[model samples]
Structure formats: C-alpha cells, structure tokens
Target chain A: MMTKEQILQWLEQFADAIAQNKEYLTQLDAAIGDADHGINMDRGFQKVASQLPKLAEQDISSVLKTVSITLISSVGGASGPLYGTFFLRASTAVAGKQELSNEDLASLLQAGLDGVLQRGKAQLGDKTMIDALSPAVTAFTQAIGQGKTTSEAIQQATAAAEQGMQATIPMLAKKGRASYLGDRSIDHQDPGATSVYLMLKSLSEVLGMTSD
Target chain B: MKKLINQPEDFVRESLIGMAKAHSDLLKVQFEPTFVYRADAPVQGKVALISGGGSGHEPLHAGFVGRGMLDAACPGEVFTSPTPDQMLAAAKQVDGGAGILYIVKNYSGDVMNFEMATELARAEDLRVLSILIDDDVAVKDSLYTQGRRGVGTTVLAEKICGAAAEKGYDLADIADLCRRVNLNGRSMGVALTSCTVPAIMKPTFELDADEIEMGIGIHGEPGRERMTIKSADEITEMLAMSIFEDIVYTRTVREWDESKGGFVDVQLTNPEWEKGDRLLAFVNGMGGTPLAELYIVYRQLADLCAQQGWQIVRNLIGSYITSLDMQGCSITLLRLDDEMIRLWDAPVKTASWRWGS
Candidate 1:
C-alpha cells in the first residue's frame, strides 16, 4: 500500500526534478516550440509544492483536487489544463482514500490517463504527453494485474514511459505549436512527453524508497 | 535580454496597470483573475464581446477593448493563455442579459481554456457563444494537425463583430458574422528577428542578420521556411502572394450549439477571391518594425492588388497586432461584402484604434 506521505514525497520530488530540468526542457522546446515549456511547468509545480503543507490535513482525494485546481489556475498553457484534468480525475478515482492499494493505484493511473486522453484528444503516436502517459498507465495496470507490488508496478510504468518519451524524438508533430513546423518538427523530443516521464519517474522513486 | 521591465514576473501586470491608468476613461482592469472590461460594461441588452490570448501582442485583445470593440479582454502571462476563471469572471462582469460571445484565437491553450470558460458560463445559466479566428495561411490545414493559427484576421473580426453587436445583432447572428469575417480573411507573416519573452529572457529563436523566417505566426513560432533575406518589395510580394493565391482552405471549428447546450464541430471553408473583389488590405508591423516600414509594405501590397484587378477599398497600415519586438510584418487581405464594408467603416473608439464617433 502507498500511504499519503508517499504521495506528498512524490509531489515534492517531482517539483524538485522540474526545477532542475527546467532549462533542459526549455532547450528541448526551443527546437520546435515557443521555448517556455520548462518555465511554465516549473511555475505551476512550484505552486503545487508550496501548497503541500496545507494539504497534509486533507484526504488523498482532497489533496489531489487542490493540486489540480492550483495547476489549472496557475499554469496557463495547454499543459495546464491537460495536467490539471489528470490530477482531477485521479482524485475522483481515489475518493475518500487516505492510502492506496495496488488496485486503487492502477485505477488512479487509468483515470488520469483517460482524463488526459479526453482533454487533449491526442491518440497514441500523435507526439504529446499521451505518448508517455498512455504506455505508463498500461504498463502499471498490467503489472498490477500480475500481482506486482505498487513500487514494482510503478517501476515498470516508468520504464515504459522512458521508452515512449524517446520514441517521440523522430515524430513529425501533428499537434500543438510544433505542428506548424511541418517537416521541421521531426527529430526534436516532445517537451510534454518528457515532462510526463519525469512525473512517473518521480513517483516510482518515492514508492521504491518506501517499499525498501 | 535587454528589456524595459522591473521584474520578469511583474511584467504583464505592470504593463496592464499602465494601460488601465492611461485609458481609465475607456476600460477598467481587474487583477488576480486579470481581465480588462469596458468602462460602461454590462450595456443593457447588448451582447457582450470578450476575447483573450497571451500577452506581448499589445493593442490586440486588451488594447481593442472599448466602445464598438471587445467588451472584455483577459490577458494571461506573456505568451501563455489565460485560465478559465479569468474568462468566467469577465463573462459574469459583462453579460447584459442578452448573451456573451468569446472571440478566441486558434492556439491550443487559448482554445482549451476558452472552451472550459464557455462550459462554466453555461453551467451558471449565462448564455455564451464562442467563435474561433484561425486565418493564418501559414500553417497548412490538415486532419492530423490543429489547423491554422489565428493571426491578423482576429483583429478585423473583433472590430466587425463588435460593430454588429453595437447595432443590436443577436448573439447567434453576431456569432455568424464573426465566422463570416474569419472565412473572408487570410494572412501570412515574415519574421526578421526572434522575439524574447520577458520570462525566458532570451530570443525565442536566433536568426542571422541576412536570414528571415517566412510564414511566422504572431508568437514567433517557426514558420514555413527560413531563407536569405530579400529586399522590402520582394518580401511583401512573397507574403501577399501567398495569401492572395491561397486555395479554398477548409478546416473544422467548434462553436456553441444552442440545441445541445455544448460545442459542436463545424467545417468551414474560406472563399476564394475573384477578380474585381473589394479588399481590405492590412499591413501590420510585428512590434519592432516601424510605421514607415509597414507603409512601404503596404505600397507593395496595394500595387499587387491593383495588378490583379482586386480593388483595395479599405486599408489599415500600422502595428495593431504584434509579437514582442520581432522585426517583421504580416499582410492580411480580407474580401469585403456590402455588410462587411459597412461594418469595417463603422465607428470605433479604443486605446490603439479609434475613428468616427
């Protein structure tokens, strides 16, 4: 079981990771986008991080709902609503739960992915956050179905997410600002997918340490 | 990196403060959820017109909010779309019991946020309609892509639609008029230099002195191609010809469906210009370029129109819409029918653009 403390740690770690990789992600976006992905994500996540202390008294569902509201209001781009919806749907899936079982975690991941897919309307291979997030959710559900622990399942999900993120490198972008580049969009790693990978990796790290 | 800013975070707010102060008689600025609304907003029974997008494009959504223009304008951070809360607040502030119309640009963030705002407004039992402006001929329309980016034509649509609203056009009729304006317009721009967002503190892209990015959008997003810079006449010809020769571009757009109480996709096709068509030619400076340069561009554009037997009945030459300090310009050619011509000639009073009463 993953406790509420682990969820808080995962968020804190993910915020730190975003701060560290901010410039790198911005650089990646400079190649094909407006070059503010890192700046925008960091702005939103830092706000989420600052609110963690206040969320301590809240249940898991409420905590995640607060994060979603903050992200949606603070992050002012396509990623804002996309990530906000993910958290909002995840919160709904885990309503009233203070901790998550493996099955609950799987449901959470699936709900979040479904929200992103519905919000962005991006299918697989469209070169978006869905590229990483869809595979990660699938891998997590599969591992959980085979009797894997939450940490092991998240580990498998992170690995799948990494591979999916890399696969975006050569895609001709069919969505977002990069789509304007046409053939020029090829060969640049998608910034949204890269950020999604970081999110899953941070969750895996927090869960892995707790399991140990 | 050199910019006239106190702090990167306060750049947008400070500029907005200055604008609100300067135009106190025209509009009022609301903080926190940051939106600018007309001073005498909630005009009795008038359909409220609201529009928004990222900052840096001055005299756009915000500067154009006044009599005979937008009722409210929500500005996000520099190059970022405003959140749904801002739009919802603006709608509530300006809705006059008739309805609300949101003039949204076709950027991804702007689209999603405005869509959410429409839903929120509807949930509160406030009638709202949204019309998308996507007239940039630069991005090729396709099923896979998000279609074209809305550019210069957005300004024209706002002016025309605002005039229609002032003339007591109903919510649905004004929505159709906005859609009509978008269908009749096409634009293409060439960027001579990359613009630096204040937060980023560097140029969005780097270009050598002799190179120019053709078909660029207003946000400094990379355009169709980068090539060696040419003379003023050649560049104007390139931008103008692309718009003039563009085919009947078709794309799907979402608008509020009153019967379903939600958005529904509608395919729209831009009309092809024939000889002897009346045109409203706009030569817009992309922030850094001067009026003299834009006039020179307009000269070339006017000559091209005359050569092709298209009559340039109306023209607006200056920087009305802009990217931040990007040394470039865009050419927009809008075919005008009788009603559009009358609306274009209608009285408008705003901070950046005003004429007649």
Candidate 2:
C-alpha cells in the first residue's frame, strides 16, 4: 500500500521534475503550440506545491482534490482543466483511502485517464496528454492484474508512458493549439504528452524508492 | 524580453492595476479573482454584458469596460484563459436583476472556462446566456482543429451588444444580437514578427526579417501559410480575398436555456456575403504596428471592397484587438443591417473607445 507520505512525495517529485524541465517542455511547445505549456504547468504545480503543506494531514483523496483545485485555478490553458479533471477524478476513485493498494492505484490512474478523455474529448493517437496517460493507465492496470506490486505496476506504467510520449513525434495533432499546425505538427514531441510522462515517471520513482 | 514591467510574474496584474487607476472614473478593479467592473455596475433593469479573455490584447476587455461597453471584464494571465471563479464573481457582481450575457471567444480554453462559469452561475440561480464569437477565417473547420478563432469581430460584437443592452434589450434579444454580429463578421490577419509572453520572456515563434506569417491568429499561432513580405496593398488583398472566398461556415455552440434550466446546443451558420453588401470595414493593428501602417491597410481594404462592388458604409480603423507587440494588422469585414448600423452609431463612453456622448 502506498502511504500518504508517498503520495506527498510523488507530488513534490512531479513538481520538481516540471520545474527542472520547464524550459525543455516550453521549447517543445514552441515548435508547434503557443510556447507556454511548460510555463503554464510550472505555474499550476507551483500553486499545488504551496497548498501541499496544508493538505499533508488530509486523506489521500482530499490531498489530490486540493491539487486539482489549485491547478484548475492557476494553470489557465488546455492543460489546466485537463490535468485538474485528472486529479479530481482520481481523487474520487480513491476517496477515503489513506493508503492505496495496488488495485486502488490502478483504479486511480484509470479514473484519471477517463477524466482526461471526458474533459478533452481526445482519443488514443490524438497527439495530446491522452497519448501518454491512456497507455500508462492501461499498463498499470495490466500489471496489477498480473499480481504485480504497486512499485512494479507504476514502473511498467512509466515505461509505457515514455514510449507513448515518444510515439507522438510522428503524429499530426488533431486537437488543441498544436492542431493548428496540421502536417507541420508531425516530427515534434507533444509537450502535453511529455508532461504526462513526467507525472507517471515521478510517481514511479516515489513508489520504487519506497519499496527499496 | 525588454519590457517596462517590474516583475515577470506581475505583468498582467500590474497592467490591470494601471488600467484600473487610469480608468477610475469609468471602472473599478476587484481583486482575489481579478475583474474590472463598471464604476457604476449592477445597472438596474439592464442586461449586463460581460466579456473577457487573456490580458495582452489591451483596450479589448478591460479598456472597453465603461458606460456603454462591457459591464465587467476578467483578464487572465498573458494568453491564458481566466478561471471560472473570476467570471462567476463578475456575473454575481454585475447581474442587474435582468440577466447576464457572456461574450466568449472561440478558443478552447475560453470556451471551456466560460461553459463552467455559465453552469456555476446558473446553479446560483442567476440568469445567464453565452454566445461565442468565432469569426477568424484562418482556420478552416472544427473537424480537425479548434476551428476559426474569435479575433477582430469580438471587439465589434462587444461594442454593438453592449449598446443593445444599454437600450434595455432583454437578455434573449441581446444574446441574439451578439450572435448575429458574430455571424456577419469575418477577419484575417498577418504577422511580421512574433510576440513574447512576459512570463516566458521569449518569442513564441521566430520569423526571418523578410518572411511574414499570413493568416496569423492573435496568440501568434502559425497562420495558414508563410510567405515573403509583400506590399501593404498586396497583404491586404491576401487577407481580404480569404474572407471573400470563405464558404458558408456552420458550427454548433452551447447556450444557457433559462426556461429549460440547462444548457442547449444551438447550430449557428455565418451566411455568405453577397456582392454590393454594405459593410463595416475594420483595420486593426496587432500591437506593435503603427497607426500609419494600419491606415495603409485600411486604404487597401477599402479599395478592395469597392473593387468587389461592396460599399464601406461605416469603418473603424485602429488597434482595437491586438496581439502584444506583434507587428501586423487584421482586416475585418462586418456586414451591417439597419439595426446594426444604428447600434454601431450609438453613444459609447469607454476608456479606449469613446464617442457620440
């Protein structure tokens, strides 16, 4: 079971990763988007980071909900509502869970993917955050179904997410500002997909380190 | 990157503070969830007109908040859509017991946030209706992209609709007039350079000295095509022809149905423009472009419309809606009926646009 402390660590790790790669992500977006993906995500997560302290003693669901609210209010782009709904739905799935079991984690990720799908109306291969997140959730669910530990499941999910992000390099975007590029959108990695990969990677790192 | 701002993060807020102070006689600033409301808001027995978007397009939302324009304007971060809380609060503060009409642009972020605000405001039992202004003909369709963005036409819609509300038109009539304004308007723009978002402190796109991005949107999104820089008349012809050649565009948008107490989708179609139609020609500068250049564009646009047998009955040439420091201009051709011309000529006293008082 993943403890509340681990959840908190995951959020911090995600925030730190976003802060570190902020320029790189913005550069990726500059190629095809409005060139503010990194800036927007960083702004949102920074607000979530500040609110994390007050949410430390709360239930895992409550903690995630707080992050969702902070991100929604602060992010202010396609990413804002998409990621906010992600966490909000995940929070609902894990409602009342102080610690998450493998199945609970799988459910949380799946719920997030579903929420993003509903919010963005993006399907697989749409060259959006869904490209990474959809695969990550499926991998986590499959890993957990195979009796894998939370750490192992998250590791598998992160690997799939990385692959999914890279696969967006050849996609013609069908949604968001990037879609304005049409064929020109091809050959560039989607910044949203890259950020989603970072999210899973951060979560995997937290769970894997705790397992060690 | 070389801007006159004290801090990068405080860019939007600081500008808003300056605007509030500068326009104190006409408007007042509200904090927490920042919004600029009319100095004498909650105008009893009038349908309130509320409009907002990302802040950099100065004189658009905030500057237009005054006597006969928007009742309130919510300014988001540089090129970022404002959150629903700001709109909800603005709606609560400005709702004059008649209703509130939200004029939203066609950007996905703006559409989604306004949708949420409409839902929340309705939940609070405040009457509300929303109409989207998507008149940019740069993008072709909604099938593959976010569709045509709302650009020059949005400013015109606000001005016309705000006047309609001032004339004591009910919420439904105001919403219909706003939608009609959007339907009859079409705009296209070009960019000589890209603008930098202050927080990022870098240009969104790089353009070579000789190259121009044609059909550019307000947010510096790449246009339909890029080409070598041409004469003002040639560029004006390019923008004008695109609008003239555009087919009848149709799309479905959402609106709040007070009687049904839920949202309903309304199919809207912008009709084809016929020859000899009287039009309101607007030549707008994209921030960095000078007035001399805008007049050059307007001169070309006026000539082209006349060549095509269209009459320029009324014209507004200036920097009404702008991309921050992007050196370019957009031409908007809005077909005007008798009612529209009457509303367009009505008195408006705003910080940016004031006449007929």
Candidate 1 on A115-155: residue-level lDDT in tens? 98877778898888889999999999999889888889999
Tens-digit per-residue lDDT, A102-204, candidate 2: 8888889889889888767777887999999998989988988898888898899999999999999999888888877778889999999999999999998
DockQ of each: 0.78, 0.65
TM-score of 2: 0.97
* lDDT of model 2, residue A131: 92
Number of clashes found in candidate 1: 0
- Residue B210 in model 1: lDDT: 93
C-alpha TM-score for every candidate: 0.98, 0.97
- Is model 1 an incorrect, acceptable, medium or high docking prediction? medium
lDDT of 2 by residue, B97-175 (tens): 9999999998878887788788889889989899999998888887787677899999999999999999999999999
Clash-forming residue pairs, model 1: none
Query: In candidate 2 chain B, where is summed lDDT lowest over 10 consecutive residues?
Result: B139-148
